[model samples]
Target: MLRLCAASVRLRLGLGLHPSRVSWQRQLGTHGRKESREPLNSPKRAKEFIYRLQAGERSCLLQELQNFESIAIAQETVEPSPPTAAQIKYVLFHNTLPFIGFGFLDNAIMISAGTQIELSIGITLGISTMAAAALGNLVSDLAGLGLAGYVEALASRLGMQVPELTPKQVDMWQTRLSAHTGKAIGVVIGCILGMFPLFFISDDEDKKAKTDKAKPC
Candidate 1:
């Protein structure tokens, strides 16, 4: 019995000394790779990779912008010469937006009466008034343009640098500038004078309000 028991004890000791099959498989999943030495996904490495990617993106953007600048420079070299006399005239008086706006202001001043008719004058009277204003504006513009030409001619005779625009286009531009300036000033003056009626209206409104308030309680 003692000999058999000693054999069984030796077998148990051998089994304990040796690793179990299932436990070894569970613990050594990577098989040959050393554990805890190098990480597959380290935070430091990931941050560095992201930083490199951002740097690459920035570099590409800079390159694209540089290319665009070069293209713009090339296009500029191919374009017409920069602003001079005509361009100066264009900027000062004949710019697309300002020219349209100034002319509209002139027309609006002449048409203000028809626009400000508060009473229901009916459609026909309103249309007639608007037509009269339009016709009047046309006549005024023609006279102003003629005067501008005459003045420009006189200015030339007076030995001014006005002849620098002897070129037909420039002369026409000068004439236009003169006419538009005269018209705009005349309209503004007319509009100011027309405000006289507004003063009377306000006075009448005040008197009416006072009478209403003073009525017997």
Candidate 2:
């Protein structure tokens, strides 16, 4: 009998019930209350009592857990907030600045090297200016492949940082749009600046004049 009582107390404690509050009499009353009170054997009261007990136990357990600093209840997932304008601008700046260097170097090298190639081997090989330019573009592209790392490193040294953003923010339409726009603007500006070599390049007519003057009359 003592062992049985101890087992009953253990069971009540495990189920988060007070030993003083839970009893065989209460259990029997709960089981037969519907029949005695309603005369129809309705299960509604018994189910309500069981549900209320379960809810109380759950609440008690949650409260106990909340008291401990180490234990935290996992909350429902929250939707990420939309990125702000400043964040978009920051993304644009970093993306744009690196590409500006890339575009400037690419176009400047292409123009300078193409002009030299045209004046040298292009004449002997009878290659058109367009063909010479294409060869120069190939050299530029190769150089770019090697210089890409340097450009990125320079940008980082200049304080370009990766934006602090959630995956959802990074993948948003606004962010993507701003990134592409920055690239386009940067490249355009850089390419335009790279055209400075044109000022030093003489026209085809001037070349012909110099060639004609060199020949005997």
Candidate 3:
């Protein structure tokens, strides 16, 4: 009996059970084995009980961990709210300004270069005004490719900033539509303004140039 109690105490200590709980568990074991007609000092039964307790502890810990993981996944999957009016305005501004500069430069360069090309080479090559314009557009496009970075940099320097938005909010159709609309309006305005070069070329000069091109040398 003394050996059994000592073994029980040692087993509980090894398993890191509190000393107070150990005494209670020891009493329960003693009474349990008496009722079950089992040997009080049976090492096999003691080991099996300890193993059952460890398994219960492991299962409880695993359940808690799974609950925590489920909560985290739920939070991540929740959809973000839509952007506010201020956010939409900011997005429009950020997209519009750079495109305005792009459109202005593109149209201005094309008109200037096309006029010069038509006067210089169109008559010699018998290239139509449309063909000259096309070539000028190509030059404008090439210049745009290089100037794109500068335009964006200038917009940023002028205090254009990206609005604070979640990934879902940024991807929303409303936000995307606002951005496209802003860009369209800006480019249209820029192109209209860029027609300033046409004012420099008189209608009489155009008519005279056409007449000269038609005359035989």
Candidate 4:
């Protein structure tokens, strides 16, 4: 009876060791299978990994930008010989053509109207004969004069050379006017000016040289 009771006591002690406790110890053990260790998802380690990845990306982006800048600089340096005198003249003529053409058109409209309108009628309306015609001419003249100054200032501010006004400013002005009026007023002015290119001649030697260069030699 005594031996049977001792065997029963040993069996109870073995069963008291839970299977769940054994599995937990095995899962968490670093070496020995006794104590269960806590989970090892440290906040510091996660933060460090994120920082390293961000730094790597930043470094790659900076290097790529620097390489692109170097390539652009090298390409610019390799090009030799500035544009010829003729090319420069063409550029200037193209640039200033719109403004000059607008001036001529404005004059023509005034002259044509003055020839037709009664002088006393203008005076009785409390407006000068010239002043009344000018109101009708404002849109065309303002676009040419005001827009030219604005474009020049914008180009200077942006650190870019203003292109020939014909190709650049005229196109830009026309685009702006078309957006506002859906009509190509700037384009019409450009065509008129282009038709009368001979009228743009200047007495200045430099101006003459540029004009001659722009002309077919």
Candidate 5:
């Protein structure tokens, strides 16, 4: 009988009730009393008691608290993020490289010598070779522009004020523009080459026919 009573008490405690029925009933009756005993202090009402030694309003303290809360809210609401290096490279390459390659290939044959070799090559070979050349030009252009942007970003992060350059200064180092010019020249050449046969031999092999026509038909 005593063991049974102990087990019941253990189960009640495990279930978060009082360990015995008498203790449980007492707790249930006293729940309201705990709420009524809470201190009756309101921060808004404290302003009415300003004449009291420790009850004066501290504007500086209130202002600091407001500033702290505003900062916390701003931090929570504004996400900290920036573009990755891969994204920047991707944007630069996709936006500028293809047109540059095509333009270069269009004009390639006019400038370079290896006409016989280029003629022996198929369109795929021609395109791939020209594309490679275009990519190289693009690399130089990007290197210049990228270096400038990188320096600017680094300076900004270091909290330094970088100086602005003049139009001449900016244009002098315009790598992308230089690259595009080369590409356009190449494409114009390539278009010419691709449009016409690589070489044209005159029909001078008909010299005997020409001589025979001079005699009698």
Candidate 6:
């Protein structure tokens, strides 16, 4: 009781001495974060947020595309020529998402590669390989729905479905599984867009080296 009273007294004294120090929650006179105001079940609010996110993505993609000229190429003395084995491999893996998850990826590639990651970037339409992958995101996701059918077929073939009261449960599980599978398709597409600039630097260096060697001494 005394502790409570003392805490209350201290709080009052602090408020009196520094009125500007009022807690942020109290100042706002609200108990919820800004986002909390939007009820998740409200389709209008949800659609608004999604639209805003898409608009922002489009804006960013436009900005990046506009800055292409700002990209400067520099060359230095280096080993391995243009289209060297490493460059080929890097571009291959970077463009193909670690060779469709079969090829070994270095730390950087692994860290940066992912279809969902690339699709989220949504800024590679200017590049051929990336453009194909980005544009294919929806088609791939739709095709992924086949995985759910495969699961159902496999379960029926194997008689894995429980005999108990589970038709609804199984249906629910299948829906979720199919949704996840569909999303994976987009990730695969995104991986196609991720690329490496390492080879570009080496190729530039190789070109410069050849030119310098050919110059009159």
Top-scoring candidate (TM-score): 3
The reply for model 3, stretches above 4 Å from the true place, is 1-79
Give the per-residue lDDT of model 6 (tens digit) for 1-217. 3333332222222111111112212212221234334433599865653354334444543453354323311212223233334433332332232122211111114323323333343323223335534344434333333432232223234432211212232124433343234334423543444344233335465445545655778
TM-score of candidate 5 against the unseen true structure = 0.17
In the range 1-60, model 5's lDDT, one tens digit per residue, is 333333232222222222222222222232133433222156643433222212112333
Task: Kindly give the number of clashing pairs for every candidate.
Answer: 0, 0, 0, 4, 20, 2
Candidate 1 residue lDDT tens string, 1-217: 3333332222212111111112111121212234333321698644543353334444543454475567656655453343455545433332222223223333443344433432223232434445655554544344433332243233233332221222233335444565345334533554455344444345465445545555778
Q: Which regions of candidate 1 deviate over 4 angstroms? A: 1-171, 203-217
lDDT of 4 by residue, 124-193 (tens): 3545545755653443343333443343233234432323222223234343333223112333454454
The sequence of per-residue lDDT tens digits that candidate 3 reaches over residues 1-217 is: 3333333333232222223322212222311233343433599755544564444444543454475467656657786788999988877876667667766877887898888888879867989999989888767766765665466446656755455656567568878887777777767777777778998978788768878888988
After superposition, the stretches of candidate 4 with alpha carbons farther than 4 Å from their true spots are: 1-74, 96-100, 114-123, 139-217
33-132 per-residue lDDT for model 2 (tens digits) = 3433432136875454345444444455345335432322221154667789999888787567766776677778889888888777776676788998
- Listed in order, each prediction's TM-score against the native is 0.21, 0.60, 0.61, 0.27, 0.17, 0.20
Position 127, candidate 4: lDDT: 57
TM-score of 2: 0.60
Clashing pairs in 4: 94-165, 94-166, 95-164, 95-165
**Model 3 — TM-score against the truth?**
0.61
Clashing pairs in 6: 115-187, 116-187
Worst-scoring 10-residue span by lDDT in model 4: 12-21
Residue-pair clash count for candidate 1: 0
